[model samples]
Structures are given as structure tokens and as C-alpha cells.
Target: MSAWRWLVTITRDSRSFFFTFATLCGVVPGVIGYGVMQVTNSTNPELEARLRKSARPETVMMGKVNQERLAEYLGELKQKQDTNDRYVAALRGETLTRKPYQRIQPVPKPSDTVTTKAQ
Candidate 1:
């Protein structure tokens, strides 16, 4: 029988068609993916070592807190709190004399005239 005739015959029966369709769409691709994974899979020793090192906990305990770092952190916290407070006050319709937050000014670019003079 011709290939097309055989395919028509198989498709006529629901059970046979389902088995054929499942094998073609599911099993075939699964087998192909398995083969590809097996062929392409590889291990890197350096990457493995790095992964192991990161996974392992640090042996050394944190030393005494540095007073300078603590002070700097506290100052940053205070600044953040002040900014948040100013934002909340503004939301409540309070008039702020000073700017809530300082805006970052763009750096002045060298003019074409300056570049021409330098050249």
C-alpha cells in the first residue's frame, strides 16, 4: 500500500491515530531532547569549585564594628529619614521653604568653541 493510503487507514481508527499522534508529537521529541542533553552535557572544575566555595559557610566570625563605619551609616540613615519626613510633610500640603531634596545638576559640556581652540 502507498504511504498516503496507509496513513489514511491509520487515521480512520481513533485509537491507532491517537497512538501514532502521541508517538510523533510526544515520545519522538522527548527522545530527541534526551539524546541532545546527553551529548551536550559537560562539567567545569573551576565553576564547580566556585559553586562549592559559595555554598560553604564562612569560618571566620565578623570582627568588632568599626566606629567610623557605624557613624557614616547612622548619618546616611538620618539623611534618608529626613528626606522621607519631608516627602510625607509635602504630601500633607505643608509649605517647605527649603527644597525637599537637592536635585543633581548636569555636568557642563565643553563648548564647540573650547574644542576648536584646544585643537
Candidate 2:
């Protein structure tokens, strides 16, 4: 039988169609990606170790800066940390400011008389 005929024969019911499509769409891509990653990551450990030993720790550090640039970097880091702290505090129900005074509706005095509409 042809490919289309074979697919139809295999997926005869909704359950079969669901299972087949799920396997093709989900499992197949996952297996392919895993295989690709394994092949790409297959390397000589000695080469990796040599390369690591050749590189300087400061050079490998993220956004490595000298003393001249340290102040600016620290200021930015502090600002970000403060903002994140405020956000976390707000999440914890800590009020940053006091609530504003609300206006109250005036109540009628007890001495006020009620009038009936009946004539």
C-alpha cells in the first residue's frame, strides 16, 4: 500500500489518530533534538581541559570591568536591587505610603422632621 493508505489504515479511529499525531509531533522532535545535542556535545575532554587551562579567570568572567568602571556598575546593580526589593515588599503586602483620607457622607440630624406625601 501507499504511504497515505498506510497512514489511514494505521489511524483508523480518533484514539489511534491522536496517539499517532502526538508521537509524531511531540516525541519525534524531542528525540531528534536530543540526538542532535548529543552529537554536537561529543568532544574530547582533554581538549576541553587544555582550553580551560589556557583561559584566564578574569577574561571568562561576565562583564569584567576595571576599577574605573566599577562605580557605574555598582550604581546600576544597586538601583536594580532596590527596585526588585520594592517589588518583593509590595508583593508581601507592605504599604509604601499611607492611604489618603476619604470623604464621609453627612448624616441627617435626629431633630429633622419627616413629611408624608399623602393629602
Candidate 3:
């Protein structure tokens, strides 16, 4: 048999067309995805640069001018804590390690496997 015929026989007789086609569909789109990403990156070089810069996690904010604002905020927070009484410990310059306001959820666990135990 010819190569094409051989491929058809092996693929079809084994009912692997869906598997191969599905795999190709997934892989081809992934390969195509990189190309799309490249095209998009090239098209928006400035945006890409901004995104690259932003991708780094920020621990601290910028501008010394904002310090006064922070103090004001802290003062207001202090007053609020005084009124609340529950959070007085927090306002006393004691650092409060906290859960993030908006956090990325944990990655999902891998799925269970489908097994074949032929008797």
C-alpha cells in the first residue's frame, strides 16, 4: 500500500482519526497561537513593552509625594481603628500580613487517568 493508504488504514482501522485529528487541531492552534501572539506583539510594541514592565509583581509604590497621602490615610485608619477597638493592634505600626485583596487562584490539580485493564 502507498503511504497515504497506509496512514488511512492504520489511523482508521484503529479508530484513531478522532484522536489524531483532535491532537492536530490542538497542536496546530497552539503553533498558530504563538504566531498570533508575535503578530499582536509586533503590532502593539508599546503596549507589549508596558505589559512586560507591568508583569513584574510590584512590592512598593512610587513617588515621595504620595508619602503624605499615605500618612493621612494611616491617620484616618488610626482613627477608624480607635473607634472600632477591634483593630487597635493593627494601627500601632505593627505590620499586618494579609491575604491579598485580589489574588490569583491556585492552579488546578491534574485530572484522574482513564485506565485500560483488559481481561
Candidate 4:
């Protein structure tokens, strides 16, 4: 009949103890948080005005095509294709030609020096 005795009895069974613990720790807090969120949630007038303004027909317009960006993207695709071709050539044991845009310069090896003294 006492709360302490009821808790002791519930803890004796694993299934009842698990369900009681889950209900108390998980389900109870989740329900309380949902209730609090619902009570506290309210629409802001300024946000509503901004949303209405953005949703107006005058604020919407057709996207303009950028010719420069399109040209740059095409150039990038061509460069990528050229790089893949170079890689394929290298894999086939063929010499790869450097692109005009690339500024790679080969470094020259230092010559060996030898000195002999007359006895």
C-alpha cells in the first residue's frame, strides 16, 4: 500500500521495472517538453511581414544567364579533359606535353667537380 513497498515490488520484476523506468525518464520528459514547446510557440509579426514581402510576385524574377561564368566553366572542363588525356598518355609510356598555361620549368642538375694535385 505504501509507495516504498510498491516501488520494491515493481523492482523485483525486470519487465515492470524497465517499463516504469522508461516511462519516468524518457516518455514523461518528452511529453512535458512537447507541451511546453506548444505553449511557448507564437508567430512573430516582423517575420510574417518579411515572409509576405518575399512571397510577393514583384520580388520574384527570372534568373539572368552569366556568359562569363559559362565560359569559365567550359574552360575548366577543357582543362580537366586535357589533364586526363595527359594522364592516359603517361600511363601508356608516351611523353606528355605541357600546357601553354602551365609555368613549370625544369631545374638543371649540378655538374660534378674533380681536382688532381701533381706530386
| Per-model RMSD to reference | 14.9, 20.2, 20.3, 17.6
The TM-score between candidate 2 and the true structure equals: 0.36
Better of 2 and 3 by TM-score: 2
TM-score of every model?
Answer: 0.31, 0.36, 0.27, 0.30
Write out the backbone clash pairs for model 2.
Answer: none
Tens digit per residue, CA lDDT, model 2, 1-66: 699787776677567786978789898899999999999884899988888778888765733455
lDDT of 1 by residue, 38-72 (tens): 98876878886776666624421222235544664
- The lDDT of each candidate is 0.62, 0.62, 0.59, 0.62
Task: Output the TM-score of candidate 1.
Answer: 0.31
Taking the tens digit of each residue's C-alpha lDDT, what string does model 4 give over 1-119?
A: 69978777777767877688868989889999999999987688998778767774644432123454456447758777444654455566554223556523334344444323321
Write out the backbone clash pairs for model 3. none
Cα lDDT of model 3 by residue, 1-119, tens digit: 59978877778777678588769979999999999888866657898678667763442244333675577558758777432432453465333222446222343445545333332
**Superposed model 4: Cα runs more than 4 Å off:** 47-119
Q: Candidate 2: which stretches are off by over 4 Å?
A: 1-13, 53-59, 63-119
Query: Which sequence of candidate numbers ranks them by TM-score, best first?
Result: 2, 1, 4, 3
Q: Itemize residue pairs with steric clashes in candidate 1.
A: none
